[model samples]
Target: MNRKTLVLPAVVGLLAPVLAACGGSDSGSGGDDGAIVVGTTDRFTATKDAPAPFDPAYSYDVGTWNVLRQTVQTLMIQPKGDGDPVPEAAQSCGFTDSGNERYACKLRDGLKFSNGDPVTAEDVKFSIDRARSIKADSGVFALLSTIDTVETQGDNEVIFHLKTADATFPFKLSTPVAGIVNPADYDKGKLREGFAIDGSGPYTLKTETDGDAVTKAVFTKNPEYKGVLDVKNEKVDMVSFEDADAMGAALDKGDIDVMTRTMTPEQIKKLSDAAGGNKESLVELAGLEIRYLAFNTSAPTVKTKAVRQAMAQVINRSELVSAVYGTQAEPLYSLVPASVTGHSNSFFNTYGDPDPAKAKALLKEADVSTPVKLTLNYTTDHYGAATKQEFEQLQKQLNASGLFDVTIKGTPWETFVPAERKGQYEVYGMGWFPDFPDADNFLAPFLDKDNFLKSPYKNGDIIDDLIPQSRRVADRLTAAKSLTKIQDIVAQDVPVIPLWQGKQYVASSDDITGTAYVLNSSASLQLWELSRGVSG
Candidate 1:
């Protein structure tokens, strides 16, 4: 796709308030320049710090890998603003009728990795095999478990032979986990020892400073990139901050052009009000994210179906959304948020409002004693400001039911991720930004047995039969129906209770143009489509 540039005039008007909420301000003028500045809380501080060996094969968490994956091209990529898979590194792909067990991908000719290495069928084979071998924290490999073997068919073609039938196999190929990389950059058999990222995405990491530890990630246009990227700016500057409040303060001072995961509704409103008074300065995007509560079924107390169900019933979703998030978030009941397809109100239909008496009675019937005390943990910097308050409300609601005792704890994302993966906490609050824009993306990660959660939930019928059975059908509606059934089962079992769907909120300087927002499951910013504007 041809690149598009948006230019907003610096004219003063009512647009300022919206711009202010979006992190734009009308201050002593700096004219439209070719650069875009982005502010975010916390940089991915993985042990390996170099950008050359930044292969997705060893990536588990989304923060660092996502930046790398976007820079490096994958075999396939999710379409912009949608969940459907489209071409990326590969030209085209489809399944062979070998009973839906064999899949083939055709790569675009002359495609090259950032290092000038030719992207080949052999590279595809190496990437897939390496991902499975390392089996990093990424859950994408689980989708490949069905693959029997990967063989290069020709210079531009590769085939995946599956041990069982699977139609969703192509979708798996589109995920960031399956991103293509150069085998020459690192040992294909072993994980990279240091922080080096090398791939064929839209950008490259140029310099990383260790003192204040600022990661200066820059995206250079890929000359060999033949995919559908409409990048406008020549380069994107991603600035990492240690604190959300500090990031918000920076945005207010015009030190940052874009701020992620920092602004509160009150703060956004203040910016919007400022923009309204002065036309050339601010922009605001409301409700652009999602957050939820996850139950560690491996925990003894949470393992009991009745206890899980009681906890779900006792949650006051509306109150939680209103009190903690204000108007920035809406009440959510399904694993699939309202913005996506196949979203349902199954949870609301089953359990309406908080009823402590009913919750207590359910626990009693399950032969569980009252005052069920459990510790709840959450990441300190990952979600947002409202996360702690949201969990606190949950503790209060549950405790008020007199059915359980609740304690709350918080940690940073880097520590919380591994701890939760090891099933360290009894219960924890977690948030999922979609890997892809499909309902399947939300359900598969949490419910899939090999996921990072490593949930002990074993529904042979769902995993072994229903899910795989649904994949064979190419129709999304039919696949959605099967997924809906799975959601119902999860709801009844309460492995993870539905919390609230967060709104994507953004503030941009009025001088920046061509910055149309495209919502996705990943919640990633499409830097390619952003550009400096002529006026407000």
Candidate 2:
């Protein structure tokens, strides 16, 4: 596909007063042409700081992507203004055949890594093959299973043979998961090591106090770098913090030039409560994040669709947004977030506004007893500190309705992901960060025969008919038309209840310019868009 402007949902423009008021004051905000220090409370690692902890092949976190995206070049890249996947390292990329199973790309000429190594098609093939071979926990191996083989015609050309038609393949190329790495420097069998990265991009990373999250990280313009982006800053510094409070404190003190995701909901409210500081500094994105409860459909407890729909009907999403998340999120009626092309309010239209009487009546009709016992699971450390309260509110909403014997279970994220995947929970919460911006990412992974939701409920029509048709369409609008039906299908089966969708927020100081344009469609941070103004 050729480069085009990304489509954003109208809801982003129509957010509630709380969120709408928080952003929009800082477009074209000026910054000095100098080094800018970016701070975050989130844990961060350079691609090679402690032996490439943030390597694209092994990374799955926002913080790592925030840094690597500036340095690592992908075949296709998601442009910030328009989240469309545009060519980056490659001159152009698209389907090679009508089957949509074959994909091809030609490399841009004169491309070289910071280390001055020529980037070739063999390296591209190696990088793609290596990501799947390593199969790291955070790797993109699962998504590339459709690729039967990859072949390189010459130094500039690489072609992919897909086992099945996958329309979303181009979007995947925009991610670090498909990041083009140097074959000479990286071992495909073992994860790349050390603070040395052979990257061909706008910036080159060099840590001031390496291996220490609390220290500073520096990214300087790569003189050898060749790409489509213009390097605006002379240098960029990154400071790590433990939580929003700590980062917010530093921002208040003007110790950092820019900060992203720095304020908690309580702190954000305090911006008005205290009525001081750079209020216009906040920027909220129309991001693609969906938080939901994955039901163990095969389990006898939630085996029936009536119980799933009953739970879906009773668990109030508005309350979760207003009370628990505040302006941090909006209620999502569809698994596919509204920010994407093919999103629908199938849940809201199908079952209007959380009706407890109707939910109880439905449960009774299904022969299920009162107070259907269920374990609602979540993680404390993985998502953030706020998730605990969010899950607590869910437990309250369900139990208070007198329809559910809700047990709220909390576990660390590291432990929870595997256990939840093993089908250990009757019902568990799952937050999805998209593999690609496409709406298909929202549905296919959850509904497929072997989905990320291990004990997933199967719908043959979705697996067999809707998704295949959606994936084969090359045009996004055409694909979206097919994908629109997915929400209704999921609502009918109700394997998972779409609870809420979140926005990407960056809380930079008033003078920091790129705060308003930090996120792409896939919700990856675009640090390249950032630049600093002269310190006042």
Candidate 3:
């Protein structure tokens, strides 16, 4: 539920810093000759919601985590297969108890921060505790909410005491939220103030800013990095842009080696439409980012179950994706997207297709009158400019049915986030970039009592029973029944309507290699994988 504005590539919690320098790269300075300048619209501003943008405790968006995952080393890394997490900073980690409530890990030998500080068990404990203590409203603290306490066995070992069994705990540890930081530089109580990153990951990040806006983030391969990743590039430069237009232009002009996260739908169409030879430059990965409309179930216009169900039945997801997102997204039938392991086509199986007759039948059966006035709220900045087009299309579809008289409203990301949290909108749009690859990461965050939506969706059966039961099994595939049931329950309740799932697109120069390797299954970007000097 890392909500980001359009052009803001919503990552879990990886982000760079805000500083000042000129935007984009100089023309004729790209290609196989120099550092791979990857262009993006992701900004790492230190705001009220994200006061500590670089600190693992505060940052919780994909844009931020994209950078954090490069600079900070986590206890474990996401496995390439469906098996449990593999070792990174930790030599190994697993449940030490039969109940799965106790977990322990031993740090790898010769682990050190980029600053030469020893990566000790105390540092690991401090990092986790600091994140929990700060617990920023926008932070990933909710992911770490299960931790009861932390205890160190020695300099190399750390143990976590959980309140209950959590099978997803290892997956959570693979996220950037558990990114270990050097205790000497990072204060336990507050966010470290600076654009500089001091961690032991594959890259050591340094930002060049023009005033407060970060123009470029320079990632140098960390010689001291001791992790599962094999650093491929010597240096990779991330150039920031204000919009897709500028970023796309930079890519076309060869001012940048690669452009990712957000190219406009039109830009994506142009590249995808490119004939024969030009197609080699565009790289696409299976993405987990999902866009959906969350019902303020307590709101008057959509308070009834029938009203929400009718709205869901009437939404044509295929039309919405094709009309607005083009090749960039696909129609999604479940909150847990199809790219995820436990995803189920519950909505498609339940609603079948967009049927105005059925929608009308629902309204009539509920004894509800015609032209039910509803306001569709969305953010102008988050999710891209296409969001407005999407909502307008939604408005058109609902109004044409003669059942809903819909008014669309738009706000900036700044106001939308807090307002959504307060349940100020009847039905607002939101995007979720996974905190981990599991389906639990998608279902639990929106359905829990401490859900990001803050809607009246506290279902005891789903939360108290299904979610906990799902989390008790470490093999994610084994928990599919519970996850599928949760999605079915969500579809029945109609608290949220799954709209579209995004595809990760990376447009790079023909000379750039390893663009496909940049993103993991969870869509976390590994900048080190991108290298220069490849033939077209």
What are the models' TM-scores?
0.88, 0.85, 0.89
Candidate 2's C-alpha runs over 4 A off are 1-35, 44-53, 137-139, 193-198, 206-217, 272-280, 298-300, 534-536
Ranking by lDDT: 3, 2, 1
> Candidate 1, residues 23-114: lDDT per residue as tens digits?
23343132134346677764665543222235576554445655765576777776544445777778888777757888888998788887
Best by TM-score: 3
Q: Which regions in candidate 3 have their CA more than 4 angstroms from the true location?
A: 1-28, 31-33, 79-84, 192-196, 210-212, 276-280
Per-residue lDDT for 344-460 in model 3, tens only?
Answer: 999999999899999999989999998899999998765666889999999999998999999999997656777887778989888888877778989988888667666787899
Between prediction 2 and prediction 3, the one with superior lDDT is 3
Task: Give the per-residue Cα lDDT of candidate 1 at 483.
Answer: 74
For candidate 2, list the clashing residue pairs, or say none. 31-532, 31-533, 32-532, 32-533, 32-534, 41-241, 47-52, 48-52, 48-194, 51-194
Whole-model lDDT, model 1: 0.67
Query: Of models 1 and 3, which has the larger TM-score?
Result: 3
The predictions' CA RMSDs to the true structure, in order, are 5.6, 6.0, 6.4
